[model samples]
Target: MLLVYFLLWVIFNGSFTLEICVFGLVIAGVLLGFSCRFMDYSLAKERKIYRHIFGFCGYCVLLVKEIVKANFGAMHLILTQREEIEPVLVTFHSDLKTQVGKVLLANAITLTPGTITVTLEDSEYRVHCLDRDLAEGLNESEFARYIRKLEEEKQVRKG
Candidate 1:
């Protein structure tokens, strides 16, 4: 965190000198100490974040891929199969343990082109799909799986 703070300080200042470096180091130290004292920040949390960084990056890549695929699917439905379009509302339950995981799942569904999360209460998700095909496998999607994996990683660390 100190390194990140110092880098940000240098970047924002637009120039670096010996005096500036010394000042930035002191400021970064102060900020890091303040966070540790007031914000419950610790090196353990930082290590945990570092461990999950790759998983988060993979999830992001998967999200982009899903978004692109959904875009094409939506386009095809709009351009060639407009007459057969059937919008549907589907409800499904997820086993994701954390609120963050559930919210991420909901947002990922909504971010796709052909689907929107109508409601998310507890573990149940109500999503509106542009077509029935889009609703297929909606309950156990890759998004949900990735989020479950992330949640499991947290549990594993705790255990």
Candidate 2:
């Protein structure tokens, strides 16, 4: 994790001077210390990261599709049926077992135009939607299921 952080620092800084490298090392060390205390180290192992890399990429592609669909849905609703906008607050339990997966799910929901993740507690997410249909769709999202599968895949490999 420290190595990755250092590499990212180098990339962002666009420098390889001795002083910059030393500074990056210090910063990376501090960040890594905090990450070690708060993050699941098992999930950050190099082998595990490589193992799930392809699947994670695939998930991102699917997420883009969902985002586009949500945007068009919201546009259609706004243009054609403004009066049918029945704002709803929906809460549902997420099946994703990893912190990373849960956070990704929450961010994805918020990125969609018609929905926003209000709060996440444990495995439950509360979302505010522009309409009842959007809320219902969020409650039954395939993206959530895919994220849950990703979490389970990691656990299975770790075990």
Candidate 3:
């Protein structure tokens, strides 16, 4: 955090001198102290955030891949199986513990091409799928897996 603050100070100042560097160091230290004292910020929390950054990036990549795959699947269903399409409503319970995890799962489902989350109440999710095939394995999806991993990481930290 101090390093980040110092970098920001240097970037904003546009020029660096010995005097400026000393002042920037002092300012960054003061800001870091203030954050630690009053804002509940700590090095441990910063490290945890840094660790989650890679996991979040991986989840984002998986989301984009799923979106593209779903788009093709939906397109195929619409073009070739329109008359035989079997739309379904799927209700499933998830084991994710955090509200944020549940919400993330719900939003990820809704973001997919052939599925939309109709309701998310407690641990239960009701999803409307464009076809039965899309509804299959709605509960134990990769999105849910990623979210569960995130939830577990938090739990591990707490324990």
Which pairs, if any, clash in model 1?
Answer: none
Candidates in descending TM-score order: 1, 3, 2
Query: Residue 14's C-alpha lDDT in candidate 1?
Result: 95
Q: What's the number of clashes in each of the models?
A: 0, 0, 0
Model 2 root-mean-square deviation? 5.4
Candidate 3 lDDT, tens digit per residue, 1-159?
Answer: 999999999999999999889999999999999999999999998997898888889888999999999999989998893568888998999999889889989999999999999999999999999889999888888998888988888788789
lDDT of 1 by residue, 108-141 (tens): 9999999999999999999999999999998799
Best by lDDT: 1
lDDT of 3 at 120: 97
TM-scores of the candidates in the order shown: 0.86, 0.69, 0.74
RMSD of every candidate to native, in Å, equals 2.0, 5.4, 3.4
Residues forming the 10-long window of minimal summed lDDT in candidate 3: 78-87
Q: Which prediction has the highest TM-score against the true structure? A: 1
Global lDDT scores for all candidate models: 0.94, 0.85, 0.92
Q: Supply candidate 1's per-residue lDDT for 1.
A: 88
Q: Better model by TM-score, 1 or 2?
A: 1
The regions of model 2 sitting more than 4 angstroms off are: 1-44
